[model samples]
Target chain A: MNQTSQPKLWLAQQANRFAPALFFIGLVLLWELICRVGKVPNYILPSPSAIITAFFNVEFSRWMIHLWATLRVALMGFVLSIMIAIPLSIGMMRSQLMNRILYPALIVIQSTPVVAVAPLIIVLLGTDDPSRVLITCLITFFPLVVSTTTGMLETPPEMIELSQSLRAPRYRETWQIRIPYAIPHIFSGLRVSITLAIIGAVVAEFVAAEEGLGYFIQFSTSFFKIPQAFAGLIFLSVISLLLFKSVQWIQAWFFPWSLPKKK
Target chain B: MDQAKNSAYVSMKGVGHQYAPQAPLVVKDIDLDIHRHEFVAVVGPSGCGKSTLLRMVSGLLIPSQGEVSVFNRPVTEPRDDVGIVFQKANLLPWLTVRKNVLFPLKHKYGSYSAADEKRANELLEMAGLTQFADKMPDELSGGMQQRVGIIRALLLNPDILLMDEPFSALDALTREQIGFDLLKIWREHPKTVLFITHSISEAVLLSDRILVMSKRPGTVLDLIEVDLPRPRSSKTINSPRFAELTDLIRGYIYEPDVPA
Candidate 1:
């Protein structure tokens, strides 16, 4: 009975490993079939083949330029937000007064639409990477602050007691104990904020940038080249996914203990 | 000899704690003297302020209406010579076993010396955790992790070891084994241990004296001296006296709930 079940178990494991890729391919194939058979217009919804063709229609250098533009703004904004959010969260964690003061201000900022503020920021900081980066920072920093604060606060009371018993200084306690404890939550926030960074950059580009995937999409749509716009949209998602995965990979590589344990 | 005995290494005088000005007291009118190298266990039902008593001794909690003094000095804040092992292992998962043990030195002083590292390794070796020194806390078993927590408490060579239910999280077999392990360690390197526990048999097995506390607004009910001969093990638990002591504590803590 053991021998019989072994091969069946191996097969199940193999199937489980390949199922996602298989399902994804099936979805694309079905979409392609539906598009072709239904005589779908390219302007309304471009076929997969047309999208791929349009992706390669432009010179590779031109695509690279736009990709670089969007990627730079997104990453710069992400790094900037991290710089601001972490220390802010630490400040908020260390002082009750700061938490009470900052919470309302943060909520106000979060509630106000970034879209409404983007043009004003573009006008204030000018239509450049700095303005675009600030816009992205505005969008991405809130979750980091909230998640980081929650994580730091969520540190076990016993661990806090351990720190207290050691007679460690408040700064050392926050740095060594609270910050390390908050890494998992901070990473979750980073994963969210990194993707939002991309969206924020695109939103900024929609309002002002001369070059970016968002701009390229807008440019293509204006020219009635829907397939080209679809290609640009694909680039946005692919970059967002890669950024998200990199955050997970960074956690796994540098702080593997933060990841949930496997059975 | 009487003066030395009276001048307790650690003393709490009429200690009481109320979390808020209007709130009811958690533990009140408590008085205890833990002599140098004595293993004193405080056993009570859950929320009987057994842990509150330890916190006061460690200087983590300032008693609202009394004083905790160590070696004739009042404890106003966290004392340097008091090491605490909490209920859970509470090992920092990010650090390896060796690093976790060395954490207190680094935590208190931002950096640990080579000598500190050497001391940490020695403590780990003594605890029989030398082989797993580089392994993460997550990689260790619950029993091993708790052992690491104990070793961490011992790392600083503190005069007082404040253990709040250190072995309660472990399974019965592992808890028993660790109890023996703790006895072996205490014999080698003595510290004034104030252990808080909910288990009466545990209190009987490990302590030189047990402080039984009544339920909340917890007050001291009795302090029983365990005259069981030293070098105690599972055999000690099987002895006739151990049973009597446990029965005595059980009666104090738990009235027979069943209709009798």
Candidate 2:
């Protein structure tokens, strides 16, 4: 605020911005040092440099095949869950009977761990894209439904009264007032779901898949190629990070007002 | 007084509402009449059911006993002729100022026409909010948002405007400014206004008559005619008679009705 305070404030902000990156780099250096000093073999734990070498060892076309396999299943499953979750949320909101019937069923499904059921799903639906997508959908579904419903129900009572006073149809209340109010909550759900979608794809590949980063990791570790598996894990994390950032970017591009801090 | 009661445009006779089936009433034995195009302000302490009274007239809530009628017909359901302004601006945050003003029409009819758009722009101009028409509700000051609220209420050309402590959310200076702004707008386009407030001076400053209500089981304690001259300004607030009327209403509020 004051002229004397400006430089100190700027320095504080700079420190805050670079603190995490510096910490991460320092951690990687420490790990690399420990491995070298201890004369640790590459199989037990791959050093950062070895992991980077392993990443380069894989053929470019092979990496793309695995990346596409994981991305396709994750995206399809993510899109499918959104289609089902949003409508189901609206239905539960609009109808007391539907809420009563579907609520307990949804709870039952959500509580059942997808990992526990993955083998059975692959057995029943076969080890194809369909079973894999279903697994991803199950992982991504609950947060979307819960957040969307909570947001719609949380519309201000006075706004609902305003709708009623206008004698507007009940559907308009849902479409105009309730849905827009729910956007921020829904986007938060999307951010969580996008990451979960990637996790879901990996989990599916762990059970039954020929190609994906998850499958690559499993295949590498089995062959005791620990550095290659580490490489696959790192790649998976990078993709998840990109997907999360893309969700945030979509919200900023389309519904800037829905972002709470933007205002 | 009898003739005025008989000719009242909106009247309540023995209106009462119970909290539960056999429980004590929230508001009881309320009898009042509002003439057409007159601004009536109701002031009462907290828990006096001032908002409940407004809701009953809006036909959003029903009275368990007696009746509320507007234009000589019973108010059994929310009417198209009445508009309500809530305590908060209650603007849909996603909509622009222009869209919010036209929300009632779009909400009721599913869409707005070119003519409705013209009316919205004109009203925004009148409220001196034309420049901010394209802006979101959160960008405006509290007072400016509430002015847009009043504009939204007036968009439908409703005959009765029920305002439930509309300026209560604003700071004192902004409240006074918006009160005068409301008066200016009311002069240009008059409607039967039932303004509710916690501020005694605000009631005195804005209304033709002030309805002082009792605490719990809220009944009308006094309906004092303002007797203040029209085109009221800070000069009117400075007048002695204004003090007397506010004092009269204050006396009714403070005089212990139930023995301790």
Candidate 3:
């Protein structure tokens, strides 16, 4: 009886996992039917089918060029933000002076909208790749710094005492005990920052860039090629989702102990 | 003077500590001595700075005034001669039980050797945790986790083992079980142990002497020597002498009319 129920339970679990994807497909089908039945002009709102066709019709090389451009800016900004944020957080955590001096400025920067600052950034850097990357960096930097700093500060008192009692050197304690303890929180920041990096790339491209899916959408929409604009939107969502999942995958691989164990 | 010199493996001379310079002392004028290979348990009411006293002995916290010395060396900072087990076990969640046991060795000896691995395995076997050596801390039950903690402390072969209420978080059955396991381990490999606990019965069952402490601005109220025989078991706790010692320690902890 247990053997028969085991496979049945596994099958039910698999179905449960796929339920959301089935619902999403059903929704898209309903959207396609509405677009057809209402006779909505394709320029106003292309159906899902039209968007897919437009996506495929675009020269694969052209799509690659735009996607590559956006991916480069987003990834560069994300990596730079991580590199800057982690060390800055460590410095901030280590020294009260550094924290007192920089933390208020960070909060001020976070409070000011990136949109308001993007135009200023473009003016300063004059509409170049540097300006675009900088804007993306500025947009994604806050969460990484805040989360990394919080994680470092919140290292368990017991763990700290344990390391101390071990007579662990200062650097060893920071690297082995504190940093490893902070990894989950750091990953949380990375997840948030990766999504924001994509948005930052798009926003920078919308305002200043001559390439990328954001520019593709803006240019296509202005030409009233609504299908192409919708295609670009779909591409952006897929890219963001892929980046987020990659972070999750890396987190799972590096910190498998954090995951629930199989019985 | 010769007897004091021979017996004092650890000595705290009027040690006091406060968080800030002007803050009231959490621990005050604590004078203590533990002889070589003696198992001493410190029991007190809540907020009585038993942990603070243990921290001073381990050199995790430097006392604001006076001195804590181990084997004639004044403890200015954490020394390699001491190992501490905290109340929560505090095993690095990312490390397996064996790696956690080897963590101190990685820092102390710079890197682990094959001999260290062999020793770790032996400690695991002694704790009955050899099967779970590769398992993450969360995989074990609470009692099992604290046993892993005990093995980890024993790994470095420190002269002094400072345990801060290591079994307080376990259920009563597991607590007694681990208590007996600790007794067996201590009997086999004797070290100067300074165990802090709120459980009088646990202190009675484990230690050669139990130091009872007063409430905050904590000081040693009384030191009661347990006349219990070596190789104690669960049955040791059921004895009349165990009851009498626990009752005496309880009186020291509960008597408020005594001046601080």
* Candidate with the greatest TM-score versus the true structure: 1
- Of the two candidates 1 and 2, the one with more favorable TM-score, higher being better, is 1
DockQ: which is higher, 1 or 2? 1
B157 Cα displacement, candidate 2 (Å)? 0.8
Give residue B56's lDDT in candidate 2 (0 to 100). Answer: 94
Give one digit per residue, the lDDT tens place, for model 1 in A27-89.
888878989999999999888999999999988999999999999999999999999999999
Best prediction by lDDT: 2
Q: DockQ numbers for every candidate?
A: 0.88, 0.83, 0.70
TM-score for all predictions? 0.96, 0.95, 0.92
Assess the local accuracy of residue B84 in candidate 2 as a C-alpha lDDT between 0 and 100.
91
Worst ten in a row by lDDT for model 1 chain A: A25-34
In the predicted model 1, the residue pairs found to clash are none
Fnat for the candidates in order: 0.92, 0.79, 0.84
Sorted by TM-score (best first), the order is 1, 2, 3
lDDT of 3 at B221: 90
Best-to-worst order by DockQ is 1, 2, 3
lDDT of 3 by residue, B1-260 (tens): 56743688999999999989988889898888899888999998888899889888988888998999987889999878788888979899988999999988885556899999999999999999999999989989999999999989988898889999999899999999899898888888888999999888889989999888898989889888899997888788789998888878877877666432
Give the residue spans of candidate 1 off by over 4 A: A1-12, B1-6, B255-260
Per-candidate TM-score, chain A: 0.96, 0.95, 0.93
| Positional deviation of residue A64's Cα in model 3 after best superposition, in angstroms | 1.1
